[model samples]
Target: MRLIYCCGVVLLLTLFSRVSHGGNILVFPVEGSHWVNMDVLLRALHSKGHNITIVRNSKSWYVEENSTYYHSITVPVERSLGKEVITHLISTVIDFERGALPVTSFFNMAVGMMGTFTEAHRIVSEFASAMFDDQEFLRKLKDSNFDLVLTDPCWGHGIILAKYLNLPLVYNVRWLIAGEAHFSLAPSPLSYIPITGTGNTDKMTFLQRVKNVVMYLIGQTQHHVVVTQTYQKLCEKYLGPNSDFNELSLSADLWLMRVDFVFEYPRPTMPNFVYIGGFQCTPAKALPQQLEDFVQSSGEHGVILMSMGSFVSALPADMTNEIAAAFAKLPQKVIWRHKGDRPANLGNNTLLVDWMPQNDLLGHPKMKLFVAHGGTNGVQEALYHGIPVVGIPLFIDQYDNLMRLKERGGAQILQINSVDKDNFLKAVEEVLNDPLYRMNMQRLSRLHRDQPMKPLDNALFWMEFVMRHKGAAHLRTESYRMPWYSYYSVDVGLFLFGVFLLVLTTVFILMRCLYRTMCKPKVKQE
Candidate 1:
C-alpha cells in the first residue's frame, strides 16, 4: 500500500483513525520464553484504551488476551525456524569444539557464520507464522482496528510487517546501539567491543582482549551481513511504491531504545532514537509473604540478590559451591536463584530458591547489592533500585555491559572464570563499603525515572507517528544505494587519488635515474 502524507490532512486523518481504532493493538514480540516483559508492555498499552492481541509461540499467556494471544507450537511468526536451528547447531558445534557448553572463546566464529546464513530462513519462518496469525489479529480489528505495530527489533520481521500492512511501526531496541564505531552492533560498547577503558582501568587481560576481538568479529560480521540481507529482502518484498530495502532501514521513522541514558552516559544520539528505559518494568505488587519474611529475616547486614538471568543458568554445582563459600564469609544474607535442591551445607545467612520476584527483591530497601550475570534487563533493574552490582559476566553482551557499568563507577566487574572465594568476596566488599558507588547508582536512577514520559508512552507515540506520516521518506539516507566501496569512501575519489600518487612517484624515480645517468658522463657510451 502506498501511503501519502499531505500536511494538515494528517492531523484530521489521525483523529479519524483514532476514533476508528477502538479495538486491541496486535503486537508481535520476539520468540522465546522471556516474553513476560513484552506481555507487560502489551497489558499496559491495552489499559491505556487500546486492546492487545499477542501472536507468539511462547509458553506464557496474558490473562486479558487469552482470546487474541495464540499459543500454537507451529504458528510460524518467529524470524526463522531454520536460522534458529542453524544457530543452535552452531552453538552446539562450538560447545562440542570447546568441550564446554557455555564457552565464550572461539565460539563466536561459529555464531557469526551461522547467524548470517540463517537470516533469510528465519525471515521466511516468521512471515509464515504471521500469515497464520494475521487472520485472527485482523478479526479483532474489525470492531476496533490495530492502532499500531510495536515490535522487538531483534525480530526484523516487525519492520517488514509494518511496511506491508501500512501500519505504524515503532522499533524497540533491547540493547545499546550507539558509539561512533559500530560497537560491533551489540548495542552497548562494553558488550560489543573488547579492550574497553584504558590504563589501570582496563579489565581485560592481554589474552582476553585477543579473544574478545576475535569473538566480536565473528558474531558481528555474521550479524551485520545477515541482518542487512534480511532487512533488504523484507523491504523489497513489502515496503511501498518507490520504497526499497535501503529506504526502510535508513528511514526507520522512530527508534526506541529499551535502555536508559543513565546507564549509557555522554552518548551521541539522533533525534529519531529515544530512550525508553524500564519498558520491562512491572507495577510494584506486594511481595509473597514467604519471600517478604525471608528479607525480614536478613536483618541488619541486608542481603545480596544473585541471579544469572534467564539464558545462562547457574554455574556447575562445584562453581556454585565456590560462590556459596564466598557468600558464607559476608555478613550479609544471600538469596541465590539456583534451580536445584538447597545446598547441603547451606550457611546461616543464606537462602536458595529456584526463582524469586527479581524486581521485588531489587526494590527492597534492605537489598544491599546484586551479584548478577549482567544481562541488560537485569542491569537496568539493578540501576532502577539504586543498588550496586557485582557483575559476573559470562557470554554475549554481559561482559561488555558489566565493564561499562564498572567504568561508570556503578558496579564492580567480575569474570566468570575468577568466581572463587577471594575475588567474589573482594568484589562484594568493595561495592558494599563504597558510598560513592551507591551515590552514583542513585544519580543514574533519578535520571532513569525522570523521563519526559513513560517508556511505553514514548513507544506508542512513535507508533502513531509512523501511522501519521505513513512512512518517513524524508528520513531515509540515500547512501545505501551506493556500492559498498563507494559507501566506505573507497570509490572513484579514493581510487583516483591513489592513481595520482602512483604516477607522481613513478615520474620522480625516472627523473632521478635520468639525472644520475647524465652526471655519469659519456664514458658508458664511448
Candidate 2:
C-alpha cells in the first residue's frame, strides 16, 4: 500500500510539472493559408500545455472566433480581405497573364499587384489601430501576462503590438510586408538567389541576373512606398516618432521560417531563423468511405489529385473544359477540388468535390501525381508525400515555389495562358510515364524526413526555449539595429577608399620633394 501511494504521488507530481511549465502565448495571425499553418502550430503548442490567445479580425475569412485549442480576442474592423476580393484579384491576374503583351503584362501585373498589396496593408494597419484605441482591451492584454508575441510578419500589426506591449517577439513567417523573409534577414546575393516572379534559378546567366536586380529594386521600392504610407504613420502615432516599421518588422527574437532547404535554394540564413517546412505534414490518415471507394475503383491505374488552393475557386470556363478534357484521357482516376460550373468535357473518370483532405490524399500510396497551383503549403505537402507535381502556377509566389521543384526535377511547369487539351495532356503524360520524376521526389522526401528532429518538435522546442529564456536574444543578431550603409559595409568601403587616396597623394608629394633635393646643383648649397 505504501509503494502504491508513492507511485500515485510521483504521477501527480509529473502531471503538475507539465501543467506548471505551460506558457501564455499571444498570437496575431494573417488570414487564409498563413492561418492554416499557424493553426497547426497553435494546436501543437496547445497539446504541449501552453495557453494561446489569438487576436483576430471580426471579419476573418479563415480564422474562427471559437476553437477548443485557443481563446480568441476578436477586433472589429470595417474592412478585411474577403473571398470575393481575392477571387477578383486572382481573375485579374489570370487575365493579365493570358491576354496582355509580354512587356506590357509585366508592368501591368506589377502595378496591379502593388495597388492590391498597398490596400491590404492599409486595412491591417487600421485593424491594429482599432486594437490600440481600446483602452480596456489593452488593459486586458497587459494583465494577461503573456510571455511572448507569436505572429506572421506578412502583416505589420503584430510587430507593432509586441513593441507596444514590450514583449519578446517571435515570427511564424515566410514573407514580410515587402517580400521574402530572407531578403530582410539573410545575405541574398542577386547573382545566385532568384527574386520572386523572375522564374530564374540559382544558376543564372547575365540577362537573368539583370532581371533579378531589376526585380529586387522594384520590390524594395514597393516596400518603401507602401510601408511609409501605412505602417510608418501607425508606428509614429503609437510607438512614437522614433520607431521605424522596417526595423520593428525585423526585430523578432526568433523566425520560424516556413521552408526547408530541401525545397529552397542554398542561401545564407540567420541564427534566429528556423526552418519548419512540411511541419504540417504527417502520415496519411484513412480516407472517407466514399473517397476510399473511388480510390479502390482505380484498380492499377492509381490517383491524381488536383487543387488550386483556397483563393482561386475556379478558372475560366474554357480553361476548365480543356483541363477536364485532358483528365478524361488519363487512365488514372482523378479527384479535383473545384467550386465552379461543371465543365462540359469532364469525364466519368474524374470526381469534382468542393473540398478534399489534401494532405491525407497526397500521402496515400495510390497518389501518383499532383496538379497544384503551387501555394507554399500545397508544394511542401506534395514534397512530403513524394508525389510528383504538374504545376499550373496562378499568381504571386506560386511560380517561384514550383520553380524550386522543377529545378530539382520533381515537377513540370505549364503556363496558365498556354495550357490546353494538348499541352496539359502532354505534361501530365510526361510526369506520369517518366520514372525519374517519381524517383527524384522520393529522394527529396528522404532528405526532408532525415532531419535530426521532426520539424514540428524543433519549432516547439524553440518556442518553449524563448519562453524559458524570456527571449532568444543570444541567437538573434544586432545587424538589424545597424544603418543600411553600415549593414552593407558601404560606409567602411568608402572610408577605406578615402584613406587609400590620402596615402597615394602623400607618397606622390614626398617623391617630388626627394627629386627636388637630390637634383639641386652643388653651387646652390655652397
* lDDT measured at residue 148 in model 1 versus the true structure, 0 to 100: 66
Model 1, 241-265: lDDT tens digits are 4555434444455567766656664
Per-residue lDDT over 1-526 for candidate 2, one digit per residue giving the tens place of the 0 to 100 score: 9999999999999889888999999999988899889999999999999999999988989988999999999998988887777778888889779876657666765665788889988988899999999999999999999999999999999999999999999999999987899999788999999998788899999999998999899989999988999999999999999999888888799999999999999999999999999999999999999999999899899999999998887899999999999999999999999899999999999999998999999999899999999999999999999999999998778999999999999999998989999999999999999999999999999999999999999999999999999998899788888999999999999999999999999999999999888878765878
Give each model's whole-structure lDDT. Answer: 0.62, 0.93
Q: Which stretches of candidate 1 lie over 4 Å from their true place?
A: 1-24, 32-34, 58-147, 175-220, 224-251, 265-267, 282-285, 473-483, 495-526
Q: What's the TM-score of every candidate structure?
A: 0.71, 0.97
- Candidate 1: TM-score? 0.71
Query: Residue 263: error of model 1 in Å?
Result: 1.2
